[model samples]
Target: MAVTCDLSAERFVDRWSDYVGAPPLTCGIVDVGERTRPTVSGVDPDRVRTVSDPGNLQHLHDAVETHLSELPDADRTVVYLDTVNALLDHVPIPSVTGFLDRLTSSLSALGAVSCASFETGERGERTIRPVTETFGTVFELGRLGRSLEPTDDQLSSDDVFEVLSSRSQRLVLRSLLRAEGTLHVRELAQRIAAAQTTEQPDIEQIVTRLHHIDLPKLRETGLVAVEDRVVSATEVVTEVEPYLALAHPDERN
Candidate 1:
């Protein structure tokens, strides 16, 4: 199961479509946010946790802990908290840092993967300092698809179809699919790089292909459009999904 704090489920999928093909129970997404948005049709509603109060850090922290406890000690759990900017609007910067300190350490103890976003600013910097100091890997996102910095937690999946059908498209496509709003070519490159490899990958090369090639291929299928470096997935992506479902090895568990 996945736990998302302050991030919309649709936005998460638009940013990471591979979850669509993850193992049965493993693909669940628990949304801890202030309101409910439209659910992605192919997505299971039961997996989403819609909390009304997003400002409560302790409540959010406790909710995340409970979800983590339900998984096995070795299971690869992915906890994604959207931009810390929203939380900073309500919670103190130090409190947010302390909460992340405990939260990340707890996730590390479980051997789970976790990542979150932070706006770039003086306050954003202070809040993210402790987080960056603790997490070995951290980076900024660019756009072609969208800006999504996902951890490796849910990177493992059994179905290996649809979302994983095209090696050339997986990372780029998933990032576009999960975008909650406007997406750009540069930000997409950053998100894809962070998701697929640890070593620094060529951001320029990836952006070139998305702008000149992949985005056009996706456009041909009416899944997305790229004009002036801004990319948006068509409604077609969601409608054509049910037919592409792949059998997951763990579903038989």
Candidate 2:
């Protein structure tokens, strides 16, 4: 099940479709801030519920409860809630946190996975501190790899050598930097393959190597962020840029 307040239902599916996969039974979505229920792909229209009034917490809870009632296999189910930022516009911070606490506790009892998103700021932190106490794990999204302040401590010299050791990895970082630090794995492969080989770069082979080999190395070193097959460059890339040239076969020690 998905509950969207700031995020559109369609966009949520797009981002999470890979992980969400197909459920054994019918699923549902409660979209707040939409006047009419929008068509969501791979879902029955009847299952898509909408609330025009963002302040209607009861309606939101009822919609979620209705969906929970439909699916019996709680262990395999996932409940996703988008942006707490939008929900706060209508509900007070205390009420919002209380709602999340109750919602997560209920899902926990059923053994279903519960996840939610929140923006970054003083308000977000204040709300999330209480919310995090309810949820088991928290992921810092939107800016994991990209730090506003680039520092040398984020990446070690050994990590630098290892990540830039590969021609493909070097190509990956250069390409990502040029693309403004983010690209899907396939697109990143296409760009690198096209650069290294004049003949049509074997995209599948390149993609496989990146997945199994190059990307992990870069990701481990904090030089890149890999999520749902999307690779993003962290600010650490700026520190490593100069060394990429010296790591070339001709310049290597």
Instruction: Specify the highest-TM-score model's number.
Output: 2
RMSD of each: 15.3, 15.4
Q: Summarize candidate 1's per-residue lDDT along 191-232 as a digit string, tens digits.
A: 776765448888898888777777776676556777787888
| Candidate 1 deviant stretches above 4 angstroms | 1-6, 18-25, 71-74, 121-128, 141-253
Give RMSD (Å) of candidate 2 vs. truth. Answer: 15.4
Model 2 alpha-carbon drift over 4 Å, by segment: 15-26, 122-125, 142-253
List the candidates' TM-scores in order.
0.47, 0.52
Q: Weakest 10 consecutive residues, lDDT, candidate 1? A: 244-253
